[model samples]
Target: MATLPKPAAISIRTVGPFDLGRLSRLHKSCFEEAWSRSDLAHLLAMPGGFGLIARLYEGGLVAGFDAMRGVGFSLCRVVRDESELLSIGVAPTWRRRGVATSLLQASMERCRAIGAAQMFLEVAVDNHGAQRLYEEHGFERVGVRPDYYHRPNGERVAAYTMRCDLEARCGPSRGP
Candidate 1:
């Protein structure tokens, strides 16, 4: 068994257009297929599309070490009353930490703030770790996509579609 990295000071911030390069690098490190910088830029520029990046810091370090790099990110797009979690990635070394959870929570809050009533995401069936995280965050498996993902070696993987009812989890909004 492998040991996970120690938890460090982490800050979650909204990802902007300027984060394309960093986000692209992190995505490539985590996924078999990485999204291009242009794709990330287009999504961030689209209406109701937003993203969040988590920066990991080593405590008691120099200025550069204080903001090492982005360890995780989540991208979401809202259409009408629904929001879809388009992508989420965390570096291998940063896995098992609270980075992904924090990113999801922040994204959910943003979605609710923007009047989204529900959120949905797809996770690979083999990714039990991510599935557990999503389930812990109130997402329930609703369906499955057959052969939805392809591996670098040409193997196909199925994905589970999970959904969370924002209104139900956060309760009814009091309104502005």
Candidate 2:
């Protein structure tokens, strides 16, 4: 059997309006079309909306920096018993280093704590690596949205809608 790689040391924390700039920059680094700070702040200000930031720590330093560096983020919103993962991404240099996984796990736990029974997210159909990650974390593809993503160059792409049962997959949240 192939052994899974161990994740790097990472710390995830809840973020608010003060983190809009960082979140916006991280989002821009991960996607072709970037979300502005205003957009991120708007999302975070909505009812049931929240965001998480992931910082990598190595020997108390991040990427040779003396301080922890924000490398990834996850945006989510919980409505009633359901939650939606609005966006999740890691810096290009931080990909494959388990940053995304850490953010995802934290997001699920946060949603569970807020009484969410299920969590849903849409991933670009061409992103098989992300699909695998979501599947490994108990998400299953439920449907597809045609032309869900529009590129800056006028190209459109479909996305897979995946869902995970928070109660079954994430269980109860442990106090932070």
Candidate 3:
């Protein structure tokens, strides 16, 4: 049997409007088509929008890892009782090190705190790694969107729509 790798040691924190430049740089490093600083600032400024970033530390020094570095980030929006996971990206060298998982977990906690009953996201059909991560986090495939992603080379790809029932996972609330 193959042993699963251990998750990396990191910290997650809420991202604010001031993080636009860092977020943009990280997004560019992770994706072919990246969101600009202006785009990130605008999204984060929205009423229901929020984001989280994962960072690595060692000996009390941040960004200690030469290669792994700062792990990843996640952007989400919650309105009413529903939430959408807009985007998530992990640094290439930091993939499979639990960065995305930590980000997702933190994002879910934030969403639930803000009264989100459910969360949804889309993942490219070919991205099995991301799919597995989402599944591990209780996200289920509810549908598929054909040609949902356009590649830099003009190729189109399909995406799976996944949803997670936060209320079900957390059980019933005992509050007003």
Candidate 4:
């Protein structure tokens, strides 16, 4: 039904604090509730948090744009040796463009680089698409929080907590 944008030139890589504006746009675009600029800045400054962005280039033209604006991001809260995916959104215009996948991959790599042993996140009960994505990435349902997200009508949406063993996925095995 819809066509996706052409891939960017430069492969995906870790995004640092310099890309705050771009990430802010994407965060606002994707969520009814988004992280405020102060919050995002604070997160970046946090010692255990990992933030990144995707830069696309082609033919001397940054073929792609800040997917962060009105899209999704793979984020995590790294604490001690563990991490948690904070949020992710695919720009409404850029859905199915492999952007989310790229973000996830980069986030995971960041976690590993930061010495995180595991990663986890919470998704709305109705978000099957995200659930599937996480599943494909080796995440499994570890727990659930009933009536988690508050709805406009004062109702609550259940939240499913998913988790994956980062080291297990990319590091040496410690199994029988």
- Which model scores highest in TM-score? 2
Best by lDDT: 2
For model 3, residues 71-123, the per-residue Cα lDDT tens digits are 68999999888899999998786677678888998888788777888999999
Supply the global lDDT for candidate 2: 0.89
Q: Which residue runs does candidate 4 get wrong by more than 4 Å?
A: 2-10, 58-72, 172-176
Go through the candidates in order and give each one's C-alpha lDDT.
0.87, 0.89, 0.84, 0.74
Off by over 4 Å in 1: 1-8, 61-68, 173-176
**Where is the poorest 10-residue window by lDDT in model 3?**
59-68
Total backbone collisions for each predicted model: 0, 0, 0, 12
Name the candidate, 3 or 4, with the larger lDDT value.
Answer: 3
User: Counting only residues 3 or more apart in sequence or on different chains, how many pairs clash (N, Cα, C under 3 Å) in candidate 2?
Assistant: 0
Positional deviation of 89 in candidate 3, in angstroms? 0.8
Top-down lDDT ranking: 2, 1, 3, 4
Which model is ahead, 1 or 2, in terms of lDDT?
Answer: 2
What's model 4's TM-score?
Answer: 0.81
lDDT of 4 by residue, 1-176 (tens): 76756665425555576667768888888877777777888877777776666554444433245432324565677886778888877667667777777788778767866777788899999999999888988899999999989876787899999988988775742322
